[model samples]
Target chain A: MDTEEIYREMANSIVSLDQEKAVHLANQALDESMDLLQVIEKGFGEGIRKVGDLWDEGEFFLPELMSGAQIMEKAVDIITPGLQSSGSERQSSGKVLLATIEGDIHSIGKTIVATMLKANGFQVVDLGTDVKAEKIVDEAIKGDIDIIGVSTLLTTTMVNQKKVIDLLNQKNIRNKFKVIFGGAPVTQGWVDECGADGYAENAVESVKLVKELIQ
Target chain B: MLFTNWLEDKSKIILFDGAMGTQLMNRDLEPGKIPDLLNIENPEVVKKVLASYYDAGSDMVQTCTFSSNVVSLNRHNISNLYQKINVEAINNIKAILPSEENLIVGDIGPSGEFRPPVGNASGDMWKAGFQKQAKILAPGIDLWHIETISDLQEMSAAIQGIKEVSEKPIIASMTYRKTKTRGFFTIMGDSVETCVTKLEEEKVDVIGTNCTLGSDQMIELIKELVNLTDIPISAKPNAGQPRLSGGNTLYDQPVEDYVNDIGQMIDLGVKIVGGCCGTTPTHIRKIRTLIDSR
Candidate 1:
């Protein structure tokens, strides 16, 4: 099958949450020995975007979306290095640090965004859950990350998202690292209230929003 | 009329607590993560809360071990220390008894991971997860409370594993997303009657719903459930509904509102009753006083 067909098939495996099938199709695409970049850009990236569309249309739930991202991440784990050596050259989008804010330990959403960003050619530093605001800013400053995305699944922890964003401005790093927020409790109103750079409904959109801002 | 010898001679549906996460929050636990760990990590706080339920109206205070399973423990980077933490958790609760006939229940909650048919989680993986905790807790607890269960497939497997580990009465509660709008079905579109039937088929000692929604929703489901099985029913709902404020998770339900309803549960023929999310000793105190008055 063509690389395009392979990518679509791979995307479907992700949607189906079929890790083995995803890996199988990705390996078949690899055997064709086609341009890995074309496979990733046309195949994986587009595949996940399609998955994102499913989420937007309400055809998919949180588990489905997260599984798709996991599939994509596993596939990338196998293919990214190969593409890097092929000379098509992966994009070196700036490094981004992401986490679920304090009082909220749910990381399924944040993990999805990290997976998508890495697939889309951005270096992402993930700090996991219940991350304090100071820890987030310190990482951003030390790493000089291009953007910091904060996730909060609970309302109690949502304030920490704002706290981290506010701390960013307080430390005069607001301009240095763009701040974004997302998660169940995080809303557009929250974004506006916290003076955040942007907010997305899911990890895929968060990746898109970050890419747009940095570009 | 599910038959449970909870008190040896008491013949009635069992009542469980409502909104533990909701209750703990009122006791000062921020939402997200394993708030149940307060049982060991802060037993003084946990003891005060559980003891209050005994004073208020609880025949049993479930030991804090809802997320004691390895899967939930892994969330707090305690996966490597699951055996140690879970054992300590149960031991701590057992240490501070009410000096009454009250029992200690070991709570087992969902793993939050997908299982076969929906996801790739293996039965062995799941059985291992529950067994690891149950084995450690069963010897200590008066009974094992398996709740917030979503998968029907794992219900029997969990019960069988627990039976292998302990002869303690295992009260199995499923977390169905019941609503007045959609009576007796879960968020995954499971019917309460069907779930209860499945649990009954497994012959679980006690069966009912916990987490998701509140007392009113649970009451609605029980209206259907109590009639379905002659077995005693269990209902542990949330603190009404969690409200998001200032980015912090809050349970806005009042204690009197909760206490005022224990009679309703009893009137509906509920045998056992306690609080879950928004419940504290104060709420249990009211429930106890109300029950005594009856």
Candidate 2:
């Protein structure tokens, strides 16, 4: 197949969540001496971007986004070594620390955000769920992170999102990192109340919000 | 026990309790710890919370075991406390009730892991996790109540697992978000009609929406559900949509407003009415008064 056809197949494989086809295309591209970064950017990248768009439009749900993410991650895993060996520039937008705030165990929202951020060239350190504010702040400072994203599904746990910011201020280093919050219960009012830098309603907006915050 | 049997009759509306996590937070629950773990470590605390709900005239009180499933417990690295937590949670609720007639729902929440081909967790894993919790809590519980489930696939797996351990009636509820185009659908994309149809097909004793939308929005969703099935419908809406005020997440619906909204639910043939997030005992008390007045 021509390069354009191969890229189209790769993108289609991700959109369809056909992991085997995605991997086979990645391997075929490599064997044909296709540029690995081009495969990642145009193939896996375009596919996931479309998946994100579908998700934004509510045409896709968590299962489809997650499946698509896994497929992209798989293809990226196969291509990363080649890009590294060829000394291609694999620039990251920034590092983000993501977690579901303390007292909340819901992780799907945060996981989706993590997946999307990773796909968009952001380094994400996921702290799972029910994470304490102090721990989140400590990691932000220690890891030199650019952004901290807190997620909480429970109304009660939403306070902990602010607690992370409070801890950062108490440490007198609040200006060091941008803080973003999201979840079912979160609103723009909560973002302001918590003194968070930004808020995203969903995974797609999360990437955009992070980009805006960093810029 | 009389009320427990009557719940199956579906001749009258049943009143389930309001939010447990918020009530516990009021009782000084440390934020990061698993609330279910409180059952094993502080049964008195768990018992006190259950007692308040029962005192508020909740005919049925759910155990403090919402997140006790293996997947969630393991996430906190406390999987070994799973059986103890579920067993103690029921025991604590049982200890508080004045009579065995008062139903104790073995509450189950989502496993916090998406089932494949979306995530790594398989259907077998979802079934196993829920089954493990069900078996442990089966001895003291009168029925199973799965609440705040967003995914239909996960809900199906949970019900299947719970059925393997007990023949008790299961009340399966999904949390839904209102979409402009679809009307009302779960975050996982199960619409009100779709979810009700699926839950009915699964033969769950009760089916409805809970957690995300408030009673106002829920009344409309419940109306849609009531149209789809003859099965008794339940509505456990949040007090209202959440708002941020002074760093606190506050639900805008007051007890009167909530009770008022729920009155419409009752009018529309909803058989089971309760509160989800942001609801308090006062809300439950008001609901009781409404039921009594009716």
Candidate 3:
């Protein structure tokens, strides 16, 4: 197949959520001596972008989004060695640290956001669930993160999102990284009240929010 | 048998208590604290909530065990209290129950653990946790009420778990979100038709929808649910969508608006109706007035 055809196939694999097809295409692109970076950005990257659009349009749901991310991650894994051996690196748009605040064990939403951010060219460090505000702020500072995304599904736990911001401000480094809050119960009003940079309703909007804040 | 008798009259409306969590919040249950722990920490407070629902004219009241299952307790570092929490949740309600005429539903919420590709939580884990809760709660509860689950697999697991422990009638409710492209679906993409088909296969006594959507959207979902199954339908929609203000989450849907939409749900042939998040005893009282007038 032509290079353009190969890119289309790679994109299609992700949209269809076929991990095997995506991995096969990634290996094929490498065997054909294709530019690894282009395959990732133009091929798999375009596919994830489409997934995000589909999600926003309400044609896709959380399972589809999570599955698509898993597929994209697998394809990217297959192509990573090739890029390394060629003395090249895939440039990330920014680094984001993610967590589900203290007293909340909800993980699905936060994990989807991490994967979606990865697909959109952002490096993500996910601290998993029930994370304390102190630990979250400390990790952001330690990681030199560009953005901090805090998620919570419970109203009781959402207050921790504000605590993270309060802790950041207390440290006098609140402006060093953009902080975005998300979860089922989050809203723009809450974001404003908590002094967060933005609030996203779901994983797809999370990617857009990060992009806007980072820029 | 009691459950069957309550539903014997096809035209009679079955009224359930409104939100347990919402009532607890009103009672100054600390935010972020595990609500189920109240059963152990302060049984009186839990009993008071159940008594209020009965006073509000609810035919059925749910136990405060929505999060008392093994999986959720483990998440909160209270795994040791699993059996105790489930037992107390039922006994606390049973203590203040006005009479046998008022049914006690064994409230079961989601595992807060997703199954399969969504996460690593296996179906067996879900089944085991649900079975344990049901086993402890079976004797005291009039029926099994599993609500707010978005995943079909998890819902199936819960049914199988409860079945393993008891023969009580089961009411399985899934939460749905209104989509822009497709009509309505669980966050995991289980459509109403799919849910009905699966719940039927399990021979569940009732198929229902609760949480995520407000009373108005629930009216739309009930229309779809009633068309898909012969099983009795139950709906427990939230007061409305949660909004954030002044560091608190509020469900600002007016009681008049909520009760009016509920009136529409009753007209749609919904056999069992109640409230989910943000709903109060006042809402249940209003629903009682609506159902009694019929």
Top model number, DockQ: 3
How does each model score on TM-score?
0.71, 0.88, 0.97
Error of 2 at B224 (Å): 2.1
Q: Tens digits of per-residue lDDT for model 1 on A5-41?
A: 7777776777677889878766766676767766667
- On TM-score, the stronger of 2 and 3 is 3
Q: Per-residue lDDT for A103-148 in model 2, tens only?
A: 8777878888998899878899999988899899988888889999
* lDDT for each residue of candidate 3 in B147-247, tens digit (9 for 90 to 100): 99999999999999999889999999999998887899888888899999999999999898899999988888888888888899999999888876666
True contacts kept of each: 0.26, 0.57, 0.76
Q: In model 1 chain A, where is the ten-residue run with the lowest total lDDT?
A: A55-64
Q: Decide which is better by TM-score, 1 or 3.
A: 3
After aligning candidate 2 to the native by TM-score, how far in Å is the CA of A28 from where it should be?
4.7
By TM-score, the candidates rank as 3, 2, 1
lDDT (10s digit) by residue, model 1, range B1-294: 112355355543344444455456666675564666675477676666555565555666676677777776766667776776677776666666766466677878876555632356666777777788888887777777888787665666678777778887777877765333445454334566778778878877777667665777677666777788877666666657654556455566887776665567677766667666555566666666676666
Q: Model 3's A-chain: what TM-score?
A: 0.97
What is each predicted model's overall lDDT from 0 to 1?
0.70, 0.84, 0.88
DockQ of each: 0.18, 0.47, 0.69
Is candidate 1 or 2 superior in DockQ? 2
Worst 10 residues of 1 chain B by lDDT: B1-10
Give fnat for candidate 3: 0.76
- TM-score for predicted model 2 compared with the true structure: 0.88
Candidate with best TM-score: 3
Candidate 3 ranges with C-alpha deviation above 4 Å: none
